[model samples]
Target: MHSLETVILLLVFVLGLALLAQRIHLVFPILLTVGGLVIGFIPGLPRVVLDPSVVLLVFLPPILYSAAWYTNWSDFRQYVEPVIVLALGLVLVTSLGVALLAHSIIPGFTVSMGLLLGAIISPSDAVAATTIMKTQSVPRKIVTILEGESLVNDASALVLLQLALTSVTTGAFSLENALLEFVILSVGGIGTGLALGFISFCIHKHAKLEPALETVLTFVTAYLAYLVAEHLHLSGVLSVVTAGLFIGHKQSRVHSPIVRMQAVAVWDFVIVLLNGLIFILIGLQLPHVVNAIRGQSADYLCVYGIGISLAVVVIRFVYIFMADTVSNQIRSLIHRAPIFPSRRYTTLLAYISMRGIVSLAAVLSIPEKLPNGSPFPGRNLILFITFCVILFTLVVQGILLPLVIRALAFGQPSTDYLSRHEVQKQLSQRALRQVQRLIDQDKLTGIAVQAVIAQHQMRVRELANAETAPLLDQHQLNQKLMLTSIQAQRDELINLRDRQQIDIELFHEMENELDRQEIQWHPVSG
Candidate 1:
């Protein structure tokens, strides 16, 4: 009863915080964490601890799939070197560094436990990365590297974390078996995701599903990959991401206009709610985690937390200078020219790797007891430390991320966005040329062809404003004239209504007729 009430109040508080975030044009992740910090100390407020199983099994798949679906495959592949370095290479480096640092600095911390904690905090959050990229004038390639890293790093970290947790649980560790497990699970998850994606594509392309049913399939597809991979003891995170990448890449060719429209709206709504719930849940769990760590001195814990946090920051900078060495060596063996990103790119990459919800969830999900029924050693401390790292990265690193980006001063305008605009213009022009040829051959007539060409011209204007898009052809000129006449009629109708020359019902009837004709001549969206 009290627990249920506490849950409701927390959700209500999250809702209010979201509104405040929008009002101030602030990032919601930071604000929500701050909100949680505030509420956690409010005396009499019931402590709310998130169920780890619910966080992993229920909350992760959809949100993850949504991120993967929106990821640009071309960008991911184009920056493959840096992406791999950060996602796989950097994760391994950071995990090992944290493990060594924790074991050396903190008393009674075992290698396995330190490894578990390291993996938990190693992932740079997809949400935080995307938010910072959007809020700043960061270079697109830099954004691409961060976003790509975010997509795949979780799989690396989580798999490592699980292996560590297994070591802690059963008191058994084998390098040969662990290596085999990593290979098989990762390969199997990718294979399963590809198979599910193919099946989804076949259904979407051949069945001609209605928008509603197709939208339902989108949700089902996200969960299906997750369930299948986890069932097979594979990496569910990778499976969901792989499947989403497949379907999203094929969206335009497999789905109709209406299906695409409906799916976007539904997915957008689902993602927003999911992100809000996730950060809010993260905030609400802090006080409970803090209160549980009674074994350690408060001062000791804080100092330890600061040390771990600093290790995370400093290690990234140190590692950044070293990571590309792998790529450089590979290139050298092949006799290719050496390539290194500017120092600014390296610095921005280091700064933007902010931790968030998944880290907290991973630490919280640590087993309550070992195989012999003893309480998991240092579980509460691990949870407290993980929360501290998340707060520090999400708040401190996240806040300073924009400054680093601005200082990078990547003088080039966003090449990706400019390239997209150019591509759209070229495509629109090509489409117009084809339509004009049809009219020239008399397969299409004037007003009808003019209407389509006008639409294409409008598209061109959208990519490049009207002043810059080429001067209108005769057909477009006539189309614009027709729209002008229609606007005149709509205005006249409104004037008649205002003067009471026609009843309200009659005015609407006449206006609707004009609207239909207007749509026929010029289909412009406000």
Candidate 2:
């Protein structure tokens, strides 16, 4: 088969596996990583080549943007200090710690090489953490803190990585200059992202395009922001993230529902595919990495991998505990200060530091040669170690995370029924208001007003009855049966439309009524 055709087939297969795995309540991200590893071992599979620059440019933007856009900005702002500590401060500390350890432990390894390795894996992958944590019923605050930290940490890590790499390449290391450059890059990146976001937002507002067209524009915006930031020698990851956050927050107010829905679906699919492909690429590169270390003691690679992985894991645990302690103490001193609310939730957040595609991509990006025209020391070993660490965290840690939550009794009780009821109540109230307004404005005559009022009153009564019903009792079995019947009918009608057995206009009219009825029955909260 042609290379492109082969890749298309592989992606289709991976997506199929993802769907099946999700059905059984397995985590899709970990499944993909494992699938990639298994596929990599197959001798005849096409190799997945990745240029570090291309990986960063392609994957980082949409992933970061999606996290930022969906993130609760208010919560993120409230917990900004802790997020910064985890994202920026923790990344630097981890990098330094790893560098020091590697320099001491690995024979003939320079501090610069050690720091480069440190920088490569310093930032945890947001996509991995968000995907894994999303399936659990964790508190919203903890989720927000993790999502925010993951989005921004890459910027910090990458900036540090570049500075360290420059020093290593030129044999000139200056702490003062590195610090100065870090500030300039960060400021420049944020400015670029904001500017790009605003420009994209303006274009979306002015152009009355099809939903598909607007979705395309969003894709374009991600890449454009990255390229612009990179050209200006700033952190591309930060720039794309900022633009996404800006656009996502404003998208709802500006775009039509059709555009918003279409864009969200498209972006979601893109991220999944991109993430899957990255993991697959990591697995595919393993053969080459192993070949690079051939004739060397495989035992040494094993030890090195274990040591580095342990270092990364231990450092994160220590850093999270320290940071949370300090943050809690500070919050305790101020009466008006917001608290994290739950220590157990915070600990779960610490355990969720699973590294995935981004770290692999960064490790894969290591230069082939150092400044002295010799091969970069332990480059293959680093890649091997990184892949091992990612697997251990993503597969081992990912699988065990739920058990940890359960052991700690961290899962929030299911709120699905309450949420559904709340929605129903809000819709019923809205409908009543609309009918009353019509009568007041003389839009309905006496007979029409009475008929409308009767229907509205009936809905209100039904909602009230449902609200007062014992949640776990079978006394209101008939009402529950009726609700299920109505829902089933609605689903059947939707299926009919999907099967092309109904016309669009008729389907929509019926669907709207069904929605109204469902809303009245469920009574959701705002």
Each candidate structure's TM-score, on Cα atoms with residue i matched to residue i, is 0.83, 0.82
lDDT of 1 by residue, 302-335 (tens): 9989899888888887877677666677888999
Q: For candidate 2, report its TM-score.
A: 0.82
Candidate 1 lowest-lDDT run of ten = 414-423
| Model 2, span 146-205: residue lDDT tens | 777887887788888888878778878888999999999889989999999999999889
Q: Cα-based RMSD of the predictions, in order?
A: 10.2, 9.0
lDDT of each: 0.73, 0.72
Which residue pairs in candidate 1 collide?
A: none
* lDDT computed for candidate 2: 0.72
